[model samples]
Target: MRFTFTCHATDGHARTGVLSTPRGDIRTPAFMPVGTAATVKAMSIDQVKSTGADILLGNTYHLMLRPGGERLARLGGLHHFMGWDKPILTDSGGFQVWSLAGLRKMTEAGVEFRSHIDGSRHMLTPERSIELQADLIGSDIIMQLDECTTFGSSHEEALVSLELSARWGERSKVAFGGTRATQALFGIVQGSVFPDLRKRSADALKSIGFDGYAIGGLAVGEGHQLMCQTLDVTVPELPMDRPRYLMGVGKPIDLVEAVHRGVDMFDCVLPTRAGRHGQAWTWDGPINIRNARFAEDPDPIDPTSTCPASSRPSKAYLHHLFKAEEILGQTLLSWHNLGFYQDLMAAMRAAIAKGQFQDLRARLRQRWGFAPLD
Candidate 1:
């Protein structure tokens, strides 16, 4: 099937839509669970699907380092290798390389870094990143390789990085060639916290043209206010017809606000990561299952939840599992957290469709303990 998106409804800046891919349709204001290393940590593929997730986000840097992209292609690509039939979005591995800071060197050509696993040397260029994600992994949506700067960089530094990313975006497009029939490529907007640079990056990508656009370099400690401010200036510059994705973002409040600002897609490791640490997300913020207060609590995480992990098991049992260091605690919490995220997304979609997104956003802010929006 040809890749396409259709906006079904809109309430102010917030909207709901469907991203049609050959694999399946992804609902708008969607949350994609991060599957770095071909797995979503503690949750099984079936468990992830049960959470109502329409897509998964894969990390190209890790895959290329380990099982190897070539090996994946030989074995019928990541979908076949990982047993996931849904649409998958693979990152260009630019952020991973950027995170390697002291261990990596960036040049006009690409990034060269030592593997965190075994200190193995690797070079990741825009062309190589595209080939790995598009051809080898057979990803439904492929991201372009772009340089990511720190949160407090000077405007000059951000501009240089933005220009370099734009250049790489061109190279990535050339490398991607023509694969729109079965796949799509997304260009990332990177400009730290500068509004003008962000617009420049977005305009540059629009000139090159892409199936989608991703806002990168936020949620790296710029705080919620600055991130939203950046979005206010950046999102309006993007084409309304194409899907807007916010990469590596964030808490429930962040998602609520980003959706309100017109972002259609998001991916983060927060839910599963918090779960592994014994944190469970709920409508009323997050609770730590390891706390002594839940020792004798007979209630489940959420009695109304459809997920077994959130409705079947009692809080006492989960606390015991965590206290005993059983692996089941991680698995259960991960499942419940993902389920909560999906529920949040579904609620957002429903609210947008009903033209009541503002009401939903206000309620969520109060529930999640965020200050009321100005």
Candidate 2:
């Protein structure tokens, strides 16, 4: 349960580091593809590993309601269950409950909600959330259960939510005691869009102490600029030596900007989700295979990509597969998208190590047709 972060270099605010865990060492400024139900949709675990992902994100809310946590423990943990020998990080089931909206009841104790799958009842407190993540799911990195506030909430509401989440963080830490040798518990910083409240949340989590820190409550609705602004204020308040994760974030540009603001880890479903809908992300930008122009185009999605989809398949063939509703199209596109994200992360890591992150960032902006926030 020993976790260590070794920072190798820093280019501006962006940093390159390695996170040492029991399963393996994860290169920081890393992207974790979401495997919400213990499986990354449309892709196999080996396929996911082939993309050079050092870690994967599992959803505590989904697994707990599906096969159940105790079932996963009996089956020898999530890693064995999913055939992913690499590290796994599981969210605390808070965000899912928050998203449940009218279906959930929130109080100082915890959240109670009906399962989205079966409409069954369940309660998720901080203690139970830690137990599910560490004891049952056997995740290497576990997150504290925190209330996820909405984007347009009032200042007072955000403050109250942040304080409650800090209290829950204390409970999660106490529950994670002694397991610190093999498991890491991270405290989540939640303050909506208020910078001062974000600072307060960071200070509270630091006093409570955690193996890592996560910037939550962003990317829900606040656009890229506001999200980065929140990170700008919150990141410096956290311990520089611990890994900083930006949860449920973002497109390719979002990853670059977050890293520029000192984020070390990220997980999102953008790549795979977009792939399922006949979309592809390239170094240049995103393209829709469903478009009529692709029906006659012979070029590959990304001529520079080494992935099979981007290297072997023609744009016309991919368009045909999607047009005919063939399953292989989505699978291949998912592979390519994941591969692209991994390559991007690797490039960023190298650029930061070589003190050329800003150069790389500018290059990517130019290629992707994006402009930096002014």
Candidate 3:
């Protein structure tokens, strides 16, 4: 609500800023944990908070289906419904409509598709998406409903999609109106991988205007280099005063790379999803808890990590939990990964503030055994 972004420091294209909202101040470059369906999977609200996350992302598509958005409203919004009082950002359900819907129809108005869950029919127009996020979910940061295109679409296909998305963005702004009341509406730029189309989309969004801007339509199988390259062209076109969010993005390396390219906000399911399968993300690298070499490893996941899962519990015990198929394995690993991600963001923020982001990034790449992406 009433989001304000103040750039505190800048190192190359990377900058550190704070996103002030009604719920709280989100430190950038922040990593928002994905809490689709009102929950962050294996972790409790307190556990999630302990990870140092200032905001979380909710899925508008899933909530609109099961449990229903109206139900959440009656229960006093997503914050009260999920018991997390921090800032919440909800996607406009465009990506899910493209990914999860079965039979679909796309038009100038919006998309009509059958739900992947229970075959229910739904219409997701730009106005409807805004209503769902603002009126029902009460999201602090709301995204506009825009068409998402595949990574390798032809230039013509991408141009049509981007134009339609721009129209939808206009509709979304009209639906949002000027009665934000502490809520922020963001416009998404969708142009697949075409630089000219991305510039056009960005210019259109700037013309329409929004509280923030998001880089969309990548990360759908485009490698990190292209994503970074796209940002190279698109990010400079956006307003410097507004926040920049990169939606549905990726691994630890991906986060650092995007931050280097001037992205301010991010959300992904990688950490929790990987943890559920017995993986742990450490400063050294991601390690598999199920590895036979760790069957008797007595060390914790990361002895220096502030998370209890990494500081108190040993790898041997975590390995035992995984081998035994115990639920604690998922819980512990998820906690560690979430805490690690927050720590990563915090470190980057600090580095940027000190004008040492490049130095910090180089150290991280060396420690994580990743060569620079040239």
Candidate 4:
């Protein structure tokens, strides 16, 4: 899809924008819920849509294994397959092919690995990744097959990985290289956390060219501060016209900070994963439904919440569901978490449009507090 990024506001190094795509218009500083296997876990498509999410994400590794990409394609692409007709972004399967595979081999061409599910063999190159994204799944946004390095790696190790990733990005562009269609290919900049290497990666991606740029290899294991710093250096290096995406990012504070540093798009599994465990993300803070304090609190999770699940159900009842091990516990919490994310996105869009991002961010950080989050 053709991406148009508009810098609506700037607070220090932070800025906000909107990404116009084929499926829809994605307001920048946007959070995309991870629909790993055609679903966002406990929530239905309409439930997810109600969260104010204009876009969604799919995992190439997971879908290629479970329902199979070809099966989904035959069923009418990911949109029809998942019953979500919005903009969908799919990771290139590089991270999972390396992290989830039992044994993997890498060469100058691509990487080969056995599927984590059935032990079936698969090969993932830039070309294959693009083909998988385009012909098979029809993702609105397609990411390049780049190495996602760990935080603890040595500078030399990171350098090797980043160089390989840069080279692979070139190959991915060649594979995805064409006039901009509804599906836009993005290049991932991977350098672990080293600033110089990040510059190199960004420069390489710029040289090769893409419809967008993704700050990859972050959030793998690095804490938030370093992640923010890396983005501070990396985001400015990307082409301003194309969208700047921070792949697989985290919590409320992390999102706000990255937005401050000019990241436009993100996808993460935190909300739903936490939801399944009985945690609810609210405008105030994260509330654990399993806590004894909520057992008798006869109040909606968020009475004024835009999400139906949060505004409709009471915390006391949700707590009862948790204590009774009812499936509704997961459903409600998941709904609330997604709602919170959507609310965050809305606030960011408003702040940017009003040119009051710094003020809004300070207020959010103050409301969220300096208390350490895990």
Candidate 5:
């Protein structure tokens, strides 16, 4: 597979670029809405496309266990299965394997765990993860296997996981082979919160080589400051010409901060999860529609926002829906939240290309009150 990253412009450490992949071209400073289990929960493919998302993420752990890769292949890959012609990126399921199952066994070969749903046994090695992702969806960007540990983990534990991920990254590359001509494999850099260990992980992955690099194992529990510190040391060591992804990252402020630290792409569940909880992300800050303050408020969530939820639904209506436990309310809110995130990413890319990212980030943080490290 051939992957090209072209840097369009730079503002401080932040830069805007376009990633040309066989599936499609993705504008840098991109936000991939999570479509775990091949669906962006509460929203349809057409609905998600309207949000201006260039790519969507699918979960390997979920799909492999449920409909299964073979079933997806028979169903004509994820694109046909989901009706999303745009690019699809799938996680290696390493993180899900670590987080989902009740018990898991890890070794140099791979991981063995019982399915969270029915306690069925399964093994997910680096080879199998790559095979499943490539042979099934043939995703545009594929993540390598990596151990995701919580923040404040011991340095030794983090280092071991980092080294193992590097090894798995190599295995994934070998398993990917040439048949994945349109697909690209990315390595995940995992080192918990230690800067030195992060560098070590970066160096190891670079030696192995990858289409892109992802800053994994972060945002689990480490606050924004520590995560940025890790990126501060980690990004400079990576090849600037390649895309850098910060996985499972969060709030608007977190996105801005990570961009400032040189992250090119991101994916998070905050927007959708928040929307399901009757919350909305706005220019001023995140506000819960269920809050009593919105009981009588007639204004839209954010009239200036592009997200349909932000302007289409009134605060009072949204509050009523959330209070009444209506599903449409959550669906609309999720759509709006996703739209807001895409809009934010577009704004960030534009601001960086125009050399105004610093000012933009500062203004956002000031207005958002430092983005509570959720």
Candidate 6:
């Protein structure tokens, strides 16, 4: 199927919909598990699929460095190479390259940086990024190469970054070329914390046109309130017909709030990363399985979850595994966390459909330790 988004229900700013792609339909507001190296850390492809996730987010920076994108295409693209038949979204390697800080140099052409893996030099321009994600990886959804403006930037600093990103967005669209039919290219809006610049960036992307629009440059030390305020100014500037994606945001509370602000898709590594460190996210809130109180607790992470990793293993067993430094602890918690995220998304969709999203949000915020909206 060609890429399309149809909004089926709405409650205030929150809406529920389906993103139709050739591989499958992704339900909104969707949370994609981060598969940084073609894997969701400790979880198997089957386990990731079992979590009700309709799509997975792949990292272009890491993939291009390790196995190389050309090799992946020669082996039949990422889907076949990774054993996942579902829709996949690949980010432009911009953020990863930007994070290199002292290791990278940014120019009008693109970013030049040394690989963290082997200290080898590489250049990633908008065209090259598109070629890797769209043609080489065969990703269903591809993001444009945009400079990720860091938080605490002055208006002058942000304007410079925003203009450069707009230029890159145009180049990325051009590089996409004939692949438009099978792949969806998304333009990312980057303006740091400035509302005016955010609006300008969104307008620029709309002029270039895209299958979707992504809100980037937030969740980088800017608090939750600031992120939502930025979204308030940015999301409305986007086309209502296409999908709105929030990049690198996966906190449970953040997901709920972003959906309320009208974002349809999100991806982050928090779930799996936290799992590896013994954090378990539940409906009530996040709990550390390593807490001494759980040493003898007989309850599973969630007795109601259909996922075996969530419902079958008791908290005591999980705690013991972590204490013993066993690998199974990471696998089980990772499985449970992804499952919990999917469950949260499903609940959001259901609540929106019933025009009770606000009620659900209120309950979640309170449970997750956030004060009520003033």
Task: List, in order, the clash count of every candidate structure.
Answer: 0, 4, 3, 4, 0, 0
- What global local distance difference test value does model 2 have? 0.93
Candidate 1, 1-374: lDDT as tens digits: 89998999999999999999999999999999999999999989999999999999999999999899999999999999989999999999999999998999999999999999999999999999998998898899999999987889999999999999999999999999975588999999999999899999999999999999999999999999999999999999999999999999989999999999999999999999999999999999999999999999999999998988999999999999999999999999999999999999999999999999999999888887778867
Residue 99 of model 5, lDDT score? 85
Q: How does residue 26 of candidate 2 score in lDDT?
A: 98
Whole-model lDDT for model 1 versus the true structure? 0.95
lDDT of 5 by residue, 1-374 (tens): 36788999999899999998766789999999999998999999888999899999999999999899999988999989989998999999999888864589888999999998899999999999998898876677888888886677799888888888888888988898866667888999988888899899999999988889998988888788888888889999899889999999988888998899888999999899999998888888888889998989998877887667677778999999999999999998999999899999999998997789888988898888874332
Task: List the candidate 4 regions with Cα displacement exceeding 4 Å.
Answer: 371-374
Q: Can you write out model 6's per-residue Cα lDDT over 1-374, one digit (the tens) per residue?
A: 57999999999989999999989899999999999898899989999999999999999999999899999999999999999999999999999999999999999999999999999999999999998998899899999999999899999999999999999999999898854776899999999989899999999989999999999999999998899899999988989999999999968999999999899999999999999999999999999999999999998989999989899999999999999999999999999999999999999999999999999999999888899866
Candidate 4, overall lDDT? Answer: 0.85
Cα lDDT computed for each candidate against the true fold: 0.95, 0.93, 0.92, 0.85, 0.88, 0.94
lDDT of 2 at 216: 96
lDDT of 3 at 77: 93
Off by over 4 Å in 1: none
* Cα-based TM-score, every candidate: 0.99, 0.98, 0.98, 0.95, 0.96, 0.99
Alpha-carbon error at 1 in model 4, in Å? 7.8
Question: In order, what is each prediction's RMSD in angstroms?
Answer: 0.8, 1.2, 1.2, 2.2, 2.2, 0.9
Stretches of candidate 2 off by over 4 Å are 372-374
Q: For candidate 4, what is the TM-score? A: 0.95
Q: Judging by lDDT against the true structure, name the best candidate.
A: 1
Sorted on lDDT, best first, the list reads 1, 6, 2, 3, 5, 4
Error of 1 at 360 (Å): 0.9
Q: Which candidate do you rate higher for TM-score, 2 or 4?
A: 2
Distance (Å) between predicted and true CA of 53, model 4?
0.6
